[model samples]
Target: MIRIRKAETADAESLALIGEQTFRETFGAFNTKKDMDEYCTKNFGTRIQQNEIADKNKCTLFCESDNRIAGYVQINLNAAFGAVADTSQAEIQRFYIVKNLHGKGAAQALMNAALDTVRRLNIKHVWLGVWEKNLRAIAFYKKFGFEQIGEHVFLLGSDPQRDIILHKTF
Candidate 1:
Protein backbone atom coordinates (compact mmCIF):
# COMPACT_ATOMS: atom_id res chain seq x y z
CA MET A 1 0.00 0.00 0.00
CA ILE A 2 1.07 3.57 -0.62
CA ARG A 3 0.93 5.88 2.36
CA ILE A 4 0.81 9.65 2.06
CA ARG A 5 2.10 11.92 4.80
CA LYS A 6 3.73 15.26 5.42
CA ALA A 7 7.40 15.15 4.55
CA GLU A 8 9.96 15.70 7.30
CA THR A 9 13.63 16.58 7.10
CA ALA A 10 14.48 12.92 7.28
CA ASP A 11 12.84 12.36 3.92
CA ALA A 12 14.78 14.98 2.02
CA GLU A 13 17.29 12.73 0.30
CA SER A 14 14.63 10.24 -0.75
CA LEU A 15 12.48 13.06 -2.03
CA ALA A 16 15.42 14.40 -4.00
CA LEU A 17 16.02 11.01 -5.57
CA ILE A 18 12.38 10.71 -6.47
CA GLY A 19 12.41 14.22 -7.93
CA GLU A 20 15.41 13.48 -10.11
CA GLN A 21 14.03 10.17 -11.29
CA THR A 22 10.57 11.55 -11.91
CA PHE A 23 11.80 14.71 -13.64
CA ARG A 24 13.98 12.73 -15.98
CA GLU A 25 11.27 10.21 -16.76
CA THR A 26 8.61 12.84 -17.20
CA PHE A 27 10.50 15.48 -19.20
CA GLY A 28 13.16 13.47 -20.95
CA ALA A 29 11.08 13.30 -24.10
CA PHE A 30 10.72 17.08 -24.26
CA ASN A 31 14.38 17.88 -23.47
CA THR A 32 17.78 16.55 -24.27
CA LYS A 33 19.14 14.04 -21.77
CA LYS A 34 22.03 16.33 -20.90
CA ASP A 35 19.72 19.23 -20.25
CA MET A 36 17.47 17.07 -18.11
CA ASP A 37 20.42 15.86 -16.10
CA GLU A 38 21.69 19.36 -15.45
CA TYR A 39 18.27 20.71 -14.55
CA CYS A 40 17.45 17.89 -12.17
CA THR A 41 20.88 17.89 -10.58
CA LYS A 42 20.77 21.63 -10.00
CA ASN A 43 17.15 22.13 -9.11
CA PHE A 44 16.15 18.94 -7.29
CA GLY A 45 19.27 18.42 -5.28
CA THR A 46 18.97 17.15 -1.70
CA ARG A 47 19.78 20.58 -0.30
CA ILE A 48 16.97 22.20 -2.22
CA GLN A 49 14.40 19.59 -1.23
CA GLN A 50 15.75 19.70 2.31
CA ASN A 51 15.35 23.42 2.43
CA GLU A 52 11.79 23.13 1.23
CA ILE A 53 11.05 20.51 3.86
CA ALA A 54 12.46 22.82 6.47
CA ASP A 55 10.22 25.69 5.44
CA LYS A 56 7.00 25.84 7.39
CA ASN A 57 5.12 27.69 4.67
CA LYS A 58 6.09 25.07 2.16
CA CYS A 59 4.23 21.77 2.50
CA THR A 60 5.72 18.62 1.15
CA LEU A 61 3.88 15.28 0.97
CA PHE A 62 5.54 11.97 0.50
CA CYS A 63 4.13 8.72 -0.86
CA GLU A 64 5.73 5.79 0.90
CA SER A 65 5.55 2.10 0.23
CA ASP A 66 7.47 -0.47 2.17
CA ASN A 67 9.02 2.44 4.04
CA ARG A 68 10.49 3.90 0.86
CA ILE A 69 9.37 7.14 -0.75
CA ALA A 70 7.88 6.53 -4.17
CA GLY A 71 6.77 10.07 -5.02
CA TYR A 72 5.93 13.46 -3.55
CA VAL A 73 4.29 16.87 -3.99
CA GLN A 74 5.44 20.29 -2.81
CA ILE A 75 3.10 23.22 -2.36
CA ASN A 76 3.34 26.84 -1.27
CA LEU A 77 0.30 28.44 0.28
CA ASN A 78 1.58 31.98 0.10
CA ALA A 79 3.30 32.07 -3.25
CA ALA A 80 1.67 30.03 -5.98
CA PHE A 81 -2.04 30.10 -5.35
CA GLY A 82 -2.47 33.79 -4.52
CA ALA A 83 -3.12 35.24 -1.08
CA VAL A 84 -6.45 34.63 0.59
CA ALA A 85 -8.06 33.34 3.76
CA ASP A 86 -6.79 30.39 5.74
CA THR A 87 -6.69 27.45 3.29
CA SER A 88 -8.86 29.37 0.86
CA GLN A 89 -6.15 29.40 -1.79
CA ALA A 90 -2.90 27.55 -2.45
CA GLU A 91 -0.47 27.18 -5.33
CA ILE A 92 0.66 23.65 -6.06
CA GLN A 93 4.20 24.39 -7.07
CA ARG A 94 5.33 20.85 -7.74
CA PHE A 95 3.72 17.42 -8.01
CA TYR A 96 5.52 14.31 -9.17
CA ILE A 97 5.33 10.52 -8.99
CA VAL A 98 8.17 8.14 -9.57
CA LYS A 99 8.40 7.04 -13.20
CA ASN A 100 8.19 3.37 -12.43
CA LEU A 101 5.06 3.97 -10.33
CA HIS A 102 3.22 6.35 -12.64
CA GLY A 103 0.24 4.20 -13.55
CA LYS A 104 -0.16 2.70 -10.12
CA GLY A 105 -2.27 5.64 -8.89
CA ALA A 106 0.53 7.17 -6.84
CA ALA A 107 0.13 10.60 -8.43
CA GLN A 108 -3.59 10.61 -7.88
CA ALA A 109 -3.13 9.50 -4.31
CA LEU A 110 -0.63 12.26 -3.66
CA MET A 111 -2.88 14.86 -5.30
CA ASN A 112 -5.87 13.73 -3.30
CA ALA A 113 -3.86 14.10 -0.12
CA ALA A 114 -2.80 17.62 -1.05
CA LEU A 115 -6.30 18.65 -2.01
CA ASP A 116 -7.66 17.12 1.15
CA THR A 117 -5.27 19.23 3.13
CA VAL A 118 -6.45 22.28 1.24
CA ARG A 119 -10.06 21.43 1.99
CA ARG A 120 -9.21 20.77 5.61
CA LEU A 121 -7.82 24.29 5.74
CA ASN A 122 -11.03 25.53 4.07
CA ILE A 123 -9.24 26.30 0.84
CA LYS A 124 -11.44 27.08 -2.12
CA HIS A 125 -8.99 26.83 -4.97
CA VAL A 126 -5.81 25.15 -6.19
CA TRP A 127 -3.51 25.75 -9.15
CA LEU A 128 -0.46 24.47 -10.96
CA GLY A 129 1.56 25.04 -14.15
CA VAL A 130 2.51 22.47 -16.73
CA TRP A 131 4.74 22.64 -19.75
CA GLU A 132 2.68 22.82 -22.96
CA LYS A 133 4.47 19.87 -24.43
CA ASN A 134 3.80 17.68 -21.43
CA LEU A 135 0.48 16.37 -22.66
CA ARG A 136 0.41 13.55 -20.15
CA ALA A 137 0.75 15.88 -17.16
CA ILE A 138 -1.72 18.33 -18.67
CA ALA A 139 -4.25 15.56 -19.00
CA PHE A 140 -3.55 14.40 -15.48
CA TYR A 141 -4.18 17.90 -14.15
CA LYS A 142 -7.37 18.11 -16.16
CA LYS A 143 -8.52 14.88 -14.65
CA PHE A 144 -8.35 16.59 -11.28
CA GLY A 145 -10.49 19.52 -12.50
CA PHE A 146 -7.69 21.96 -13.26
CA GLU A 147 -8.34 24.23 -16.25
CA GLN A 148 -5.88 26.16 -18.31
CA ILE A 149 -5.80 29.68 -16.94
CA GLY A 150 -3.05 31.14 -19.13
CA GLU A 151 0.21 30.56 -20.98
CA HIS A 152 3.70 31.92 -20.58
CA VAL A 153 7.19 31.37 -21.88
CA PHE A 154 9.37 28.95 -19.92
CA LEU A 155 13.12 28.67 -20.32
CA LEU A 156 14.08 25.02 -20.30
CA GLY A 157 17.59 24.10 -21.28
CA SER A 158 18.73 26.48 -24.06
CA ASP A 159 15.28 26.70 -25.60
CA PRO A 160 12.06 28.40 -24.66
CA GLN A 161 8.71 26.67 -24.47
CA ARG A 162 5.20 27.66 -23.55
CA ASP A 163 3.77 26.69 -20.15
CA ILE A 164 0.06 26.45 -19.56
CA ILE A 165 -1.13 27.49 -16.15
CA LEU A 166 -4.07 25.54 -14.78
CA HIS A 167 -6.30 26.08 -11.80
CA LYS A 168 -9.19 24.39 -10.02
CA THR A 169 -11.99 25.90 -8.02
CA PHE A 170 -13.23 23.87 -5.10
Candidate 2:
Protein backbone atom coordinates (compact mmCIF):
# COMPACT_ATOMS: atom_id res chain seq x y z
CA MET A 1 0.00 0.00 0.00
CA ILE A 2 1.09 3.57 -0.68
CA ARG A 3 0.46 6.42 1.72
CA ILE A 4 0.80 10.17 1.21
CA ARG A 5 1.37 12.68 3.99
CA LYS A 6 2.67 16.18 4.66
CA ALA A 7 6.41 16.28 5.10
CA GLU A 8 7.70 17.52 8.43
CA THR A 9 10.95 19.22 9.35
CA ALA A 10 12.09 16.02 11.04
CA ASP A 11 12.16 14.35 7.61
CA ALA A 12 14.77 16.86 6.41
CA GLU A 13 17.61 14.39 6.03
CA SER A 14 15.51 11.90 4.15
CA LEU A 15 14.12 14.59 1.91
CA ALA A 16 17.58 15.88 1.14
CA LEU A 17 18.87 12.43 0.31
CA ILE A 18 15.96 11.56 -1.94
CA GLY A 19 15.96 15.00 -3.51
CA GLU A 20 19.59 14.73 -4.53
CA GLN A 21 19.32 11.15 -5.69
CA THR A 22 16.19 11.61 -7.75
CA PHE A 23 17.44 14.87 -9.27
CA ARG A 24 20.68 13.25 -10.36
CA GLU A 25 18.86 10.21 -11.67
CA THR A 26 16.61 12.42 -13.74
CA PHE A 27 19.02 15.05 -15.05
CA GLY A 28 22.52 13.80 -14.50
CA ALA A 29 22.93 12.32 -17.95
CA PHE A 30 22.10 15.56 -19.73
CA ASN A 31 24.44 17.69 -17.61
CA THR A 32 28.14 17.73 -16.97
CA LYS A 33 29.32 16.15 -13.74
CA LYS A 34 30.67 19.45 -12.49
CA ASP A 35 27.39 21.26 -13.13
CA MET A 36 25.32 18.47 -11.60
CA ASP A 37 27.51 18.33 -8.52
CA GLU A 38 27.40 22.09 -8.05
CA TYR A 39 23.62 22.27 -8.42
CA CYS A 40 23.01 19.38 -6.05
CA THR A 41 25.35 20.75 -3.41
CA LYS A 42 23.74 24.19 -3.59
CA ASN A 43 20.16 23.00 -3.52
CA PHE A 44 19.81 19.66 -1.76
CA GLY A 45 21.22 20.12 1.70
CA THR A 46 19.42 18.94 4.83
CA ARG A 47 19.25 22.48 6.15
CA ILE A 48 17.57 23.69 2.95
CA GLN A 49 15.04 20.87 3.10
CA GLN A 50 14.29 21.63 6.73
CA ASN A 51 13.73 25.31 6.03
CA GLU A 52 11.45 24.55 3.09
CA ILE A 53 9.43 22.04 5.11
CA ALA A 54 8.92 24.63 7.83
CA ASP A 55 7.73 27.34 5.44
CA LYS A 56 4.04 28.01 6.05
CA ASN A 57 3.51 29.15 2.45
CA LYS A 58 4.78 25.88 1.05
CA CYS A 59 3.36 22.36 1.10
CA THR A 60 5.59 19.32 0.81
CA LEU A 61 4.04 15.88 0.44
CA PHE A 62 5.77 12.54 0.56
CA CYS A 63 4.66 9.18 -0.77
CA GLU A 64 5.54 6.15 1.29
CA SER A 65 5.37 2.56 0.15
CA ASP A 66 6.31 -0.24 2.51
CA ASN A 67 7.39 2.40 5.01
CA ARG A 68 9.93 3.98 2.69
CA ILE A 69 9.67 7.14 0.62
CA ALA A 70 8.76 6.48 -3.01
CA GLY A 71 8.14 10.04 -4.21
CA TYR A 72 7.55 13.64 -3.16
CA VAL A 73 5.95 16.90 -4.36
CA GLN A 74 6.55 20.46 -3.24
CA ILE A 75 4.07 23.26 -3.86
CA ASN A 76 4.52 26.95 -3.19
CA LEU A 77 1.36 28.96 -2.56
CA ASN A 78 3.08 32.31 -2.23
CA ALA A 79 4.52 32.71 -5.70
CA ALA A 80 4.32 31.89 -9.38
CA PHE A 81 6.25 32.57 -12.53
CA GLY A 82 5.46 35.92 -14.18
CA ALA A 83 3.39 34.24 -16.87
CA VAL A 84 0.71 33.41 -14.37
CA ALA A 85 -0.80 36.85 -13.76
CA ASP A 86 -3.24 35.78 -11.10
CA THR A 87 -2.20 36.22 -7.52
CA SER A 88 -4.40 33.26 -6.68
CA GLN A 89 -1.99 30.87 -8.28
CA ALA A 90 0.38 28.31 -6.80
CA GLU A 91 3.59 26.84 -8.17
CA ILE A 92 4.50 23.16 -8.33
CA GLN A 93 8.07 23.85 -7.38
CA ARG A 94 9.40 20.30 -7.39
CA PHE A 95 8.00 16.86 -8.09
CA TYR A 96 9.92 13.63 -8.32
CA ILE A 97 9.64 9.86 -7.91
CA VAL A 98 12.22 7.11 -7.59
CA LYS A 99 13.47 6.13 -11.07
CA ASN A 100 12.73 2.45 -10.48
CA LEU A 101 9.13 3.32 -9.59
CA HIS A 102 8.51 5.43 -12.70
CA GLY A 103 6.03 3.08 -14.37
CA LYS A 104 4.22 2.41 -11.11
CA GLY A 105 1.30 4.46 -9.72
CA ALA A 106 3.40 6.53 -7.31
CA ALA A 107 3.55 9.64 -9.52
CA GLN A 108 -0.17 9.64 -10.05
CA ALA A 109 -0.84 9.28 -6.35
CA LEU A 110 1.52 12.11 -5.54
CA MET A 111 -0.05 14.36 -8.19
CA ASN A 112 -3.55 13.59 -6.96
CA ALA A 113 -2.62 14.67 -3.47
CA ALA A 114 -1.00 17.84 -4.77
CA LEU A 115 -4.02 18.76 -6.84
CA ASP A 116 -6.25 18.04 -3.87
CA THR A 117 -4.28 20.54 -1.86
CA VAL A 118 -4.64 23.11 -4.64
CA ARG A 119 -8.39 22.64 -4.67
CA ARG A 120 -8.62 22.85 -0.89
CA LEU A 121 -6.74 26.13 -0.97
CA ASN A 122 -9.04 27.52 -3.69
CA ILE A 123 -6.10 28.30 -5.92
CA LYS A 124 -7.19 29.70 -9.27
CA HIS A 125 -4.29 28.29 -11.19
CA VAL A 126 -1.18 26.16 -10.89
CA TRP A 127 2.10 26.55 -12.73
CA LEU A 128 5.56 25.05 -12.98
CA GLY A 129 8.82 25.43 -14.83
CA VAL A 130 10.14 22.35 -16.62
CA TRP A 131 13.46 22.09 -18.38
CA GLU A 132 12.92 22.39 -22.14
CA LYS A 133 15.05 19.32 -22.65
CA ASN A 134 13.12 17.22 -20.18
CA LEU A 135 10.63 15.70 -22.57
CA ARG A 136 9.41 13.05 -20.18
CA ALA A 137 8.58 15.53 -17.45
CA ILE A 138 6.95 17.91 -19.93
CA ALA A 139 4.74 15.10 -21.20
CA PHE A 140 3.73 14.16 -17.68
CA TYR A 141 2.76 17.75 -16.93
CA LYS A 142 0.79 17.92 -20.17
CA LYS A 143 -1.13 14.83 -19.06
CA PHE A 144 -2.11 16.78 -15.97
CA GLY A 145 -3.63 19.58 -18.14
CA PHE A 146 -0.74 22.01 -17.89
CA GLU A 147 -0.18 24.02 -21.07
CA GLN A 148 2.93 25.87 -22.02
CA ILE A 149 2.54 29.59 -21.44
CA GLY A 150 6.05 31.02 -21.79
CA GLU A 151 9.71 30.39 -21.22
CA HIS A 152 12.19 31.27 -18.54
CA VAL A 153 15.87 30.85 -17.82
CA PHE A 154 16.89 28.18 -15.33
CA LEU A 155 20.43 28.11 -14.01
CA LEU A 156 22.20 24.85 -13.34
CA GLY A 157 25.53 25.99 -11.93
CA SER A 158 26.70 28.52 -14.54
CA ASP A 159 24.66 26.97 -17.33
CA PRO A 160 21.68 29.03 -18.43
CA GLN A 161 19.03 26.68 -19.75
CA ARG A 162 15.57 27.36 -21.03
CA ASP A 163 12.61 26.14 -19.02
CA ILE A 164 9.10 25.93 -20.43
CA ILE A 165 6.63 27.62 -18.16
CA LEU A 166 3.36 25.71 -17.93
CA HIS A 167 0.12 26.60 -16.24
CA LYS A 168 -3.29 25.07 -15.60
CA THR A 169 -6.23 27.26 -14.76
CA PHE A 170 -9.00 25.89 -12.60
- Report lDDT (CA) for all predictions: 0.81, 0.92
Q: Which stretches of candidate 2 lie over 4 Å from their true place?
A: none
Provide C-alpha RMSD values for all models, in order: 2.6, 0.9
lDDT by residue for model 2 over 54-96, one digit each (tens)? 9999999999888999889999988867766688989999999
Q: What would the TM-scores of all predictions be?
A: 0.88, 0.97
Lowest summed lDDT window (length 10), candidate 1: 79-88
lDDT for 142 in candidate 1 is 92
Task: Return the top candidate by lDDT.
Answer: 2
TM-score for candidate 1, residues paired by index: 0.88
Q: What local lDDT score does residue 80 receive in model 2, on the 0 to 100 scale? A: 66
